[model samples]
Target: MPKVSRRAVLALSAAAPLTLPAIARAAGPADAKFEALAKGWVDANLRLNPVGATQVGDHRFDDQIDDMGPTGRAAIIKLATETLAALQATPRAELSRANQVDAAILENQVRSDLWTLQALQPYAWDPLTWNAVAGGALYNLTAREFAPLDVRLRSATARMQKLPALLAQARQELVPARVPKIHADTVVGQNKGLHSLVDGIVADGAKLAPADRARLEAAAKTCKAAIDEHQTWLETVLVPGAKGEFRLGAALYDAKLAFALNSPLSRAEIKARALAEMTSLRATMYDISARFLAGKPGAPPTPARPTDAQRQAAIEAALEYAYAQKPARDKLVEAAEATLVEATAFVRARNIVTVPKDPVKIGLVPEFQRGVAVAYCDAPGPLDKGQQTYYKISPIPDDWTAAQADSFLREYNSLGIQEVTVHEAMPGHYLQLAHANAYPSVLRAVLSSGPFVEGWACYAQDVMADEGYLDRDPLYLLVHLKLQLRVCANALLDQAVHVDNISRDEAMKLMTVQAFQQEREAAGKWVRAQLSQAQLPTYFVGWEEHKALRKQAEAKWSKSFTLKRYHDGILSFGSPPARFAGQLLFDLPIA
Candidate 1:
């Protein structure tokens, strides 16, 4: 992943080390000062958090697992507190414009970390936090070949050896009653993944030198036992005792959203924008639906002066055409592979943006990573030598009935998959992040802005539809508009579910009735909204910000503006927040 999923960005999670920022050219005294501090902090943080270091392509501390107790937290707190004080003391104007953007990213990220650890204290209440670190550390070591197999296996073994101690720390730290039921339940389902990672690494032990193989096997046995122990704890202790509220409530939600977006818009502003976008998109969807069903035998009449019910019925009827087109349940991976090629050809033919030649492939989403999201673009870390990115899709669980499968397939129908492909690959994440990694500074790359990365993908979807992808099929455009409507609902749902005490029934109605999402889609999203705070809004917020920036670019660049040029220019800077990227694009004040 270009940036670790927001839900997994905890201190011990398989997240990027909260490292320092990058330097800019022709730096001033303040720039030089910031550079020195950043360098010191990056080196120290990497030393402190080995799993993060490994994932980011640093190999120095591969054999270590992060210490998970008060002692480890103390070290990170000391580092961030000291660094943040120094950063705040340095006046923002003293740095170059480029440096100022990185500085802002650094400050915001560090503050978020502090808030998570010191105030929110999720480690005590969130079982998912423990599961992430336990699973992510081993997964990172084995997932890519940043080092040789034997070398990586040894690192994995070392981490495996520490699994029991880490679980023990979890048991000691976590308060059962404070653990949210969803979190406890989710972790119970995911704990076995730890065993899977351990077993996979140990299975490869035969390739290692005799003594090394011996150590690996020994570590695996112990790790497997620890995982089982943890699984038992999850089922018997955490799940039964779990009673904490799932919502973040207004105060905590607002604070995290600020740190998450770093955009100028506030919670109220995002909600208002979402409400307006929802109305406008529904109107557009209705128009497309009307065109699509104009000659249908028994279509709902979409009168020019239609009531709200008329518009709703027309759009719902039109969506049946999309829902009717489905890929076979067994052929999802094959169908997505085909759709990817088509998407790539379309982007190249239309010159949507500079399409990257970076190697990307379709793969099944790892079972452990399956529950939270349907798909993710798992790009190579900026530091990794292996350049392949996997566009992973979750497979239907075998336990699901045909009805459940049908609901899911309808939501991700043939055209919908193509739209998703456009968002995850082609000129979306794979391409955007390839450009992001090429930026000379790894500062922003170390801790990319969530909105910038997610925002670009959503914008890519808009670009495809605007440029008449799929032969300008109104049905396809209708599909895109349908998904776009969900984007708006996401922003609204993030606030409503957390801050406004919105009931589950209200959220379902908002998605299914208002947004027109499938029952399966709405249900999964409800769980996702509860699991992730401040992240659901990234899609809508990013799309809005990206659209605004494009308009600005069109006005400023005038005759010189082209999609290729605009895309390349904005992405030239590493993935900072979208507004910062725009500021850099126009050479405006970093403020």
Candidate 2:
């Protein structure tokens, strides 16, 4: 594993003081100081991370390239360090409790980021970042529709300018001595895609306005050079060094785990927890499957131990069935709209909480942004003034086999589709983000935690289940369980592959044999695990935390716990990690 920098460790390890200075309380013309600083922080942060900025709906730096070299790294550290100082200088008493928490979370995030940037040094040779860039560029093409062509061109140009330098840095930083074979192979596939983006998108400077064409042409040249350099570096350096182990070594893994989770649970502790939960979930699946699908009256529960070949065949069959049953593209959109209506009625009739007035639209994934997560909810930034939310779905491949299409459709059948709609459209990602966007503080929104974001979405599955949807449908229940299992499996994969020496075969068995996934699904999971960290675990963890918080809040409020009151109160705290929510709701001091 790569070693984290001493500087990063120091920044995160320091204890933050409890209160802000007196001058921070002065409500003069400088009262907007924090707000100004937040914007600046956002700008610098986004400029250094253009891909993120594009995701966040910022187009100003769309075409800019961040160095990500030692100099670039130093700038990031400085920004984080300074941001912390500004936060510390603010008087906490003057700010609302919500802002205070936001400040604290931001401070922690800055420190955490600094630590990861310097210490683990993920940028040097991390396959996750590389493949994401390669893949993310395609994804962005779909997203660029909302922006004017000129705006998109500018953004592309900026990114193109930085590509060569960035790739050069990648070549230097990626230590070929430790590259993993699985990751290297994945990158090989990704590199082909990267070249496509360059040739088809970045290299197409003629599409820009006359004024923008020259700059884009120059950027294209640079991008072409960088792409070639990185390609060579991958072939000669990183590829040769691609060993098979996934772990980032013991110490760095431990540190990353602590910061990512914001808890003291060791990898082993998390694994134990996941395993226990998986056992209970498996038993629950048996009961539920038997109760709902008792056609044979006493048939055994669905088996998990499908042999590799068997699993592949079963999944292929499932996919075939799915495609056969799927609606036409337009009908698919209609179904989603209908499901959203039903979900809204369900929530409203139950009077459980507030629903955002924001209009939600379901759309197909655009050509450029093809290989991001299968589906993602693109909500407006928290600081944005509008209420538009987009639920983007990837279209099935044009050449998908009839059987393959069926299996895919089955995985997202009517009940399963409703579950997704509840989570991503009417009341899941759309609703949560709508409320979070209304949060008074900018810092919290800018630095939102992944666990909180994903956890809320996962929790919505059960929330809808409890509220009633295709009530007691066996397949529906199976879908939910499968999703939850993905979360649990994520924690296991991170721990097993990285912390322990779990092989690809073992990982395949875990998902296919233990969790009952298909081969294609299992292979996809393997790629995802290697490419990201501290994310897959969030769905389950977030669900766990959200459940616990709601339970505690319900108990505390008792008779006073109106659904709206509880929900409004919960969301009013902004979008910090639910752990932070636990502290704020209970009036407990920061842990």
TM-scores, one per candidate: 0.96, 0.79
Every candidate's lDDT: 0.81, 0.63
Model 2 misplaced stretches (Cα beyond 4 Å): 1-40, 58-60, 82-96, 130-148, 191-241, 264-269, 295-345, 363-372, 395-410
For candidate 1, write residues 1-591 as lDDT tens digits: 233632233111122222223435746788888877777777777777777776666778777877768998888888889989999898788888887887887788778778888888887998777777777778877776667799889888898898799998999999999888888878887887776778788788999999999999998999899988988888888899999999999989998899889888999999999999899999999888888899899999988878999999999999999999999888889888998999899888987666666567888876566688888887766677544577888888899899999999999999999988888887778777777776655556677877777888889999998888888898899989898888899999989999998999999999999999999899999998888899889888888889999999999999999998888788778678888889888978887
Measured by lDDT, the strongest candidate is: 1
- Listed per model in order, the count of residue pairs whose N, CA or C atoms clash below 3 Å is 0, 26
In model 2, what lDDT does residue 195 have? 56
Expressed as tens digits, the lDDT of each residue in 94-175 for candidate 2 is 6644555666666777878788887877765566465565445434543435476666767777677666666666677677
Models, CA RMSD each: 3.3, 7.2
Query: Which runs of model 1 end up more than 4 angstroms from their true locations?
Result: 1-23
Model 1 vs. true fold: TM:
0.96
The ten-residue window of minimal lDDT in model 2 covers 9-18
